[model samples]
Target chain A: MRLELGKIFIKDVQFSDETRVENGILYINKEELLKEVSGDERLRSIDVELAKPGEEVRIIPVKDVIEPRVKVEGKGGIFPGFISKVDTVGSGRTHVLKGAAVVTTGKIVGFQEGIIDMTGEGAKYTPFSKTNNIVLVCEPVDNLPQHEHEEAVRMVGFKAACYLGRAGKNVEPDEIKVYETLPLLEQVNMYPHLPKVVYVYMLQSQGLLHDTYVYGVDAKKIIPTFIYPTEVFDGAIVSGNCVSACDKNPTYVHMNNPIIEDLYERHGKDINFIGCIITNENVYLADKERSSNYTAKLVEFLGADAAIISEEGFGNPDADLVMNCNKIEEKGIKTVLVTDEYAGRDGASQSLADSTPKGDAVVTAGNANELILLPPMKKIIGHVEAADIIAGGFAGSLREDGSIEAEIQVITGATSEVGFGYLSAKGF
Target chain B: MKLKPVILTNNPLTKSSLENKYSVLYKKEASLLDILMFARDYVHKGHRLLTHPLMGSIKPNQTPFKSVAVSKECFNDVDLLSLEIIEESILKAEQLIKSKKTPVYTDKVLEDFSLIDFDLIKNALN
Candidate 1:
């Protein structure tokens, strides 16, 4: 499979009469975009607003962030099995509204959502801060159940992104990059001298606000499977969960996974970059055992010499990571694990809840418990009271002056286990 | 045949909805630590853990409710791996609770927490 990604670099976003990308600036039609997400009976009301980088704006209780892209020339539309029909994607040309995003906001679970400040200390921690954002502030209908509320907000993000993505249909891309992976036999033969590498992509599917979806199917319902790395570019996988603000992989992260990009960079130069084997992090112990067993078997069956495994969330998923690592290593396949830490506020606690001697090559994505102070912004989107009730927050997290002091866990994607985050360290 | 699973929980939603359907050991006045310790004791008695003790990404101290499942049948010897995980979960919950005070939740927020906990473990219990 091969994919050509056309990047339309967006300079700025503004509310305009028609929703379209013009001269590198994204002009959103608020009324049209609202209508795009309207008619959901679960939503009492929905509103859209623009937030740009370097602005004194703070968006609170954010649920998900998604990039806008259009399938200009592909076998199927974007975001398969989600807002779009389920057709096998990952081939042909796609146009991306680069540097622009759709950020969904609502109080689904008080502690489940995260914060994305467009500027100030909090801005640096979230990747969304750098993108031109279309913020959706939604209110659930009176007495709507929490699960229904989560589903309502989750679909709005996808629908809004799909609506916005149409703007890039006819626009020419500033730059285009092509990615291709041949059939297993041809791929191996294409890189006979290089090491065969595979990626163990773990999806979060524990429950409710802790679930991920592939092709619109709840990941918990699926077993370990193989997928072309390029398929992810067309939204073969997406996040339907938002647990901790720091560690969860939002839809945007899945579409633009950094690990897949790094592997492609050295595809022929160093490693074979054989496709990716996807698995889930289930809450049941037996489910974990079953999934990891299949994952290791798939890696060995692919004749992989090495694999880089990335985890989503922590704690429960840590057990899955350890199992995948140990089982694959037992097959004599080298593995490199990618994950974040929760080493307490003082950084004195053990990094992960589970570990094994086989996990020798590991990369850490900072600590979720590291403390940070966010300065107050002049303008606030969504609700402000959420600061005190969020996961990393305590009773007095929201101060009288409006500033918030809590762990970095309150910031979205601050410690992304997929290497999408900016925090890391060097061992000296 | 698979042995019936025993659920140890402090979540109101779980008890109200699942009690009639499954065997539930509901703790009315238990903190996060209490339920985890209960699961640890069950594991120490040779009951294998069915669900991950630390199931949700929501930290142990942040959410007030918890629900975990353990096998009803017990062996003569304990499963050390199960004991280790439950012990670590208990310690993490204790440390976080001791370091910071749990939030004084609003009535609506409390319902939200209960719903989330039930949704996470309802499949396992069923």
Candidate 2:
């Protein structure tokens, strides 16, 4: 499969009377984009705001962040399963609104929604702070259940992104990068001398705000399966998890999975990038055992000499990580595991819930439990009071002065397990 | 409910050592709640246990002991309590104990207590 990613570098974003991209600036027609997302009756009100890099703006209780992309020459549209029809994508040209993002925030969907600070010390920790964000603050109808609210906001974000993506349809791309991976047998045959490598991508699917969708199917229902490395670029997977904000792979991360990109960078040169084996992190022990067993079998079946395993969220999924590592290594396949830590507030607690001697090559994505104070921003986009109840936040998290004292877990993509951000942890 | 005598140890000893020193003394079947209640009483009697900065010493009165003084390496085969299970058990036990009734520790609760979810219960032993 081959994917041509045409990047249109967005220097800035602003609301104007018409929605269009010109001179590297994205001008969004607020009323038009609002019309696209307002179709959902679940939302009581929807407002769009612009938050640029280096601004003193804070988007709280952010549900998801997505980069706007439009399928130009693809077999299917972007976001194959959810926003677009359930079609096999990832073999064509797609245009990206590079450096711009759609940030969905509103009333708290669950205790796991995150905060994206545009500037200050907090900005350094989150990748979203660098993007020119089109912040969607959508409030659901009164007394809506958290699950329903999460679903509503999640879909709205996609709609807004898709709507904004249309702005890049006819515009010429600033740069075009092509990525391809042949069939497993062909790939191995072409790069016979190179070591065959596979990527074991774990999705959080523990149910109720901890779920990921593959072609719009709930991930928990699916077993381990193989996908082309390029398919992820076309949005083969979407995150539904509201887990700890720091580690959860939001939609943007899913679209631009760093492990896949990095591995592709060295493909055929250092290693034969076979493909990706996607699996779920189900809560049940039997499911965990089955998924890990199938993942190992798949990697072995692919004749992979080595593999990289990445996890989403933490805690319960740690078992899955260890199992994947141990099982794959038991089959003589060298594995490198990527994950974040919850080493308590002081960074002195055990990093993971599970461990095995076989997990020798591991990449830590920083400690999510480390405490940090986010100074008050000049303007707040969403509800600031959510800081008191969100996961990784305590009762006194939001002080009267508007500053927040909370763990890094409250910040979006602060410790992305996929190596999306530069933050990482080390042994003292 | 007749309570069994429980021992609280603060030594940097393995689970086997703690068991060898105290398990025999409290051999009678007792739920974790019973042991925690005893620990609270022991602390009330002016005993102090070493505590870690992140994970403080376990206080009997505080159900779902946030931080315990034992080191992570010392938790081998001890059925150490995780925060999730401890919190759940404490909520149930408090209701029962408040009514002056013996809390029935079900197999599910016991299993949760025995199997620690390390991710959810990090720094359990500082």
Q: Write the residue-wise lDDT of candidate 2 on A253-318 in tens digits.
A: 999999999999999799989999999876544566789999999999999999999998754577
How far residue A385's Cα lies from its native spot in candidate 1, in Å, is 0.9
lDDT for A372 (candidate 1): 91
> What tier of docking accuracy does candidate 2 attain?
incorrect
- Candidate 1 lDDT by residue in tens digits, A1-428: 99999999998999999998999999988999998899999999999988999999989898999999889987988889977789899999989999999999998766556899999898988888999999999999887877788889988998898899899999989999999999899999998999999999999999888888899999998999999998999888988787798988989999999999999999999899999999999988888989999999999999999999999987899999999999999999999999998888887777887888999988988988888999999988998988888879877889999999999999999999998989876672
**How does candidate 2 score on lDDT?**
0.74
iRMSD (1 decimal) for each model: 1.4, 14.6
If you assessed candidate 1 against the hidden native complex, which CAPRI class would it receive?
medium
Best by TM-score: 1
Clashing pairs in 1: none
* Deviating ranges (above 4 Å) for candidate 1: none
Residue A109 lDDT (model 2): 39
Give the Å error, residue A117, model 1: 0.9
